[model samples]
Target chain A: MAEERTPLYRRLSRRHLFRLPLLHSRNGKRRWPIRSAGINFALGYGVLFLISATLFLSFIWWSSTNLLNDHVRAFIETDAQELRHRWGHGGAPALSEAINDRLEQNIDDDALYLLIDRHGRRMAGNLPGWPVAVKKMNHFYELTIRRYTFTTPAQFKAYTLPHGFKLIVGHDIRGRTLLSTVITRTLIWCAVMISLLAVGGALVVRDLFRRMVGSIARTASAVANGDLNHRIALTGSETDLVAETVNTMLDRINRLMEGVRQVSNAIAHDLRTPITRARNQLEEAFFSATSPDELRTAVDRAIGDLDHITGIFEALLRIAQIEAGARRSAFTTVNLNQLLSNMAELYEASAEDAGLSLALDVTPLPSLFGDERMLQQALANLLDNAIKFSPPNSMLTLSAHPVMAGTAPGSGAEKKPQGLEISVRDQGPGMNDADILRAHERFFRAESARNTPGSGLGLSLVQAVTSLHHGRLTLTQANPGLKVTLFLPLLPEAERTGRSTTPAETTP
Target chain B: MRILLVEDDPTVRSFVLKGLKEAGHNVDQADNGKDGLYLAIGEKYDIIILDRMLPGGIDGLNILETLRGQKNNTPVLLLSALSDVDDRVDGLRAGGDDYVTKPFAFSELLARVEALGRRGHNESAPETSLTVGDLTLDLLSREVRRDGQKIDLQPREFRLLEFLVRHAGQVVTRTMLLEKVWDYHFDPQTNVIDVHVSRLRQKVDKPFETAIIHTVRNAGYILRPTQD
Candidate 1:
């Protein structure tokens, strides 16, 4: 009961006005903080609304009382004017008669009229006498008068009548008193409505702000305690912008951590076999090799195994480098047709030696700005995969053609943006959708490819190269085999706008 | 030939030191960057094999840079675990004569060392034709003749023979042959260079009474006239 009388504003100020506790304690079992948060909200809003309502009511009170007083004054002035006109026509006796007549005529009304002589004797009117405090010369006044049964506030003006007579006229103004009473009652009701509205509004705003802050706090606490999977719930308010930024940052960190774990797993899983085989070969040669030639052969085989491991490391490093896009510095305006022709010439014989026919259909097109060597390597890896996978007498096709980038998703029509599509299709066992999806992943090899000689990083390298050149690589089933297509942008816009690109080797 | 090898790893140091010593080159070893820099600046050597990363404040690249800054032009082969092309470029840009990635075959290292040594010791005048006893190669006509008999070679075979003749008495590794002769940088799983060299030998050395391109034990091939 004592707390209820203390005023909500005082209670809130003494308690939780600015003591914003952002994070809850561990185990999250405490409920007082949330309850106090609600109390604080109500008290704060109640005080704010009460102050504004008081100010607005005070203004209305002053203006309404003022208007009533002005109306009373206007009536008094008109009555005085009529008395003066009577005196001008029929002398001082006539003016006195008119005053008496006016008093009698407004007897039922709250009108008050008084005729005073030079010595200040009251002749007639409901007022006991002209109050001495009221100024005698022409002046308007608000005076309290004693009536027969009651005292009421009155507004009047004193007028000097004909031949040393004074006429003071006023109205009772009981209606102004009633109006004040009603306004005061309205003010009280307004305060009550504000209290209710403050409570309702505070509940809504407090729920929104508190829930938002609470969600952020929970997510931060989870992340700080090393639970990286936790994320802030985004209901997409204006404040969700912050959640979006934080979530993306967390996602990036999570991806990097996952990448580190995957790379370590790959290293442990992939390099262990080669190292063990090399170590075993060395041990076997040390114990069992009877001849120097046999020992040399064993050592060479062991070295070969070690070399394979090193090659894997090299491939990993190259992929990392390509992903870094450091080789973009070596970009030049490369003739794609000429580059493909050279690649064809270099690997065509090797493909034939494997009893596979290599076909190339490269049409002359606009040159692209890219790392020439990286592109060649990408093409070479594709051809190498084709040769490795294709059966004898099967043909491999390499073709380059112009392509168009499609419109945004959900569009009914296709949009054509200038680009080039280069594909390497081989006539062999193609991969399924799942394999195609994971093909670009590092150290991911198909089951059939396990028997073949590869580090399983060829496609990953190709993907890296394509991304570095701002291109995309997609693997599709070529019916009989796999078809790998690379879509590349024509020229980097920076090169076109800034004129910064210079060919690494100029050939006219 | 005199060589200075600056390697921090004790095992790698002993391995390279033993190989170079067995190859008949005088070698001085430094186990740390400080000692390596001290020896490299104080003594003259036919070739310097330096690891890009080393213990102590003085690193291999810094030492090489300091030496080059002081007008030291000794051929330096940089060894690094950093195997990417950018790393290789960085090493060469820091004045390295050649860059070799770690976990390298000793044959590759020894061959590069011998080549750098010979390249350092050779006379400055450019030679259009090279002669080793009765074996002769004409650079202008792109011809190889032994005892006044002409030898025919393919384009790649001709480039391979030309490199051997240019570094006539020096060793050349299989990797060097692949890079210099074929202009290919990737390492193949198979020993393809051996097949190409064998083919070249059938035409260049088989018809002759004496073998010219001799494969060194655990090293590489040396294009020198064989002694009877």
Candidate 2:
């Protein structure tokens, strides 16, 4: 009963568990019973397209059929009205003659005519009898009837004339039926075409997205497994931009990873020498000391070596702290003039003791917003490098000046570099071009400077601190020596283009 | 001086206890925070060396806060492996007198503990002028005069001499001087402090017949008063 109650299309395609294509016996490929992404997309688009096409065809079906039926009914009514007028003017014989004249002309090929007399006898019309279906119909009625010229369903309307005489009129409905058949065929063809197109489009789209996302996921997994060089391959499409952005992020990660590895390796490599030397000194002092004084001196030297090792660790910790950016919360406006003056004063006496001339040239600068302690450390490292490397009687110059964004000295096209330029130049044996490139890298000491009694983490710490303060560190050759410049960004300009964005602002 | 050491680590506790005892201070030890809180509240000590991460219900901060709540104004030095500046700030803000990160030299810890101890006991007298064996520092005038001969000293040198003279005969390490005199908590990675102290030494004791400032070997400076 329920199967009969359901519509024809729904009953034909009703989902059944037994009919599901879980296992394809022909190929044994075992296709999934559930709809794939392509099928889902196809169904979604096809149903939408078919619904609209059906609606359009349905409108044409209604208008064409209704026009044909209305035309036939109106024609028959006019003929009957004319016949009644003829009957009143010239009695029954004139009316009968007019009917025979209309039948003889037969303008419409599918037209029908039937006239029944008062005693239900045939009159002057072509039909042998009236249809029994519309007998109870009041004055006008329409129904399909058997006709000699039309094999399909026919439409006819009958009207009662004066004195109970009935006149029936109709036309063959094959044209209206053919018109509906043409509309329904067009609708079915359009639906089939739309379904095929939707399926094809869905397959193409699914494959495209799958390929793009697959490559990225594969690269991501490869990278997670410690293949640092892995990168997503671009397909030269709009998604390439997304791939490019991911590649940029990957590059940064790779660089940071290399930095971390370099730092750890440096910690192991650079520290081992001092540790071995200190151990050797202690052993030698213990085994073959001539006097208490010599032993004591050896022990003191060992202690000194141990202290240097501790100092390296301390510097590493401090750099880690700066890189972690814990000191940024303490940013306050600091007067650079006063700070530099005091620092110059602090280092002046030492330079003098070393027989080096210290020149301080500071230009006016706006108050900076940063941690004073960290900035002081960065400046201290630069000045310390200058002093330590400069020969006696050499002049070491330290200067500060503001540089606007468009006015990067030496080149006018530099962009967004507006900040205070603080430089320390030393007239000593300067680094070569190659050394200057990696000067700020951790534990990156020049080959010739290996014998120098210093940890190479100084400039690394300086760079870390400068970056924490939203500043930059630049190392350049000063002809005869090295020129290290620190760029501390001015406050207002940093806030303009949304730099210095804190976590609170980003999250909310 | 008396100190209460609340450290769960046996090795660190023994090391610190030995250093404090060798430095001529009495010490009490507790392995956990609850016992530490009890000892701290029940008795008076010159200073408390509390470990920040204690293995008990009451951590170092909680104990310190509880003590402060009970109106205990005893000085505390929180020791921790947390070297971050924020952690230090939090430790100090929780009523700790000082914060010293771990892997510290015994000399540094000893110096800070002695400084805190001196601060606590010296709160009563509040001396205006400090004198060490005729090395007189006029706090009001900011002058250092040795043996009736006025020593012209730079302002930084004056502050250094003043600190030494105030903490006379106590072992004042380079770290302490860097923190107390230079206001720099970071290690300078050089003997910059030693150089400044040497410069200060020349002006203060070079011409004197009896040298006031003495370098304690492998430790720090001590201004021993000379008895004629």
In TM-score terms, which candidate is top? 2
Residues A370-464, model 1: lDDT tens digits: 87767877887888888889989999999887665564322322444467879999998989888888998888988878898888888887888
Error of 2 at A351 (Å): 3.7
How many clashes does each candidate structure show, in the order listed? 0, 0
C-alpha TM-scores of all predictions: 0.61, 0.69
Interface RMSD of 1: 3.5
lDDT of 2 by residue, A1-508 (tens): 1222123223222332245435585787777553446545655676777777878888888887888878866776776677778878976678778878877787665666677778998776766576677665335554566557555666666767778887676666678878977887797678657756765776686787788788988988999998979998888878788888888778767856765676688888989988999999999999999999999999989988987888888788788666655567777788888888867866776777777888988867668877887888888888787888888999999898877776654234334436788999999899998888888877888886787778888898888877776777888889889889887777674563444322111100
Error of 1 at A352 (Å): 4.8
The residue pairs in collision within model 1 are none
- Each model's C-alpha lDDT? 0.78, 0.78
RMSD for each of the candidates: 10.2, 8.4
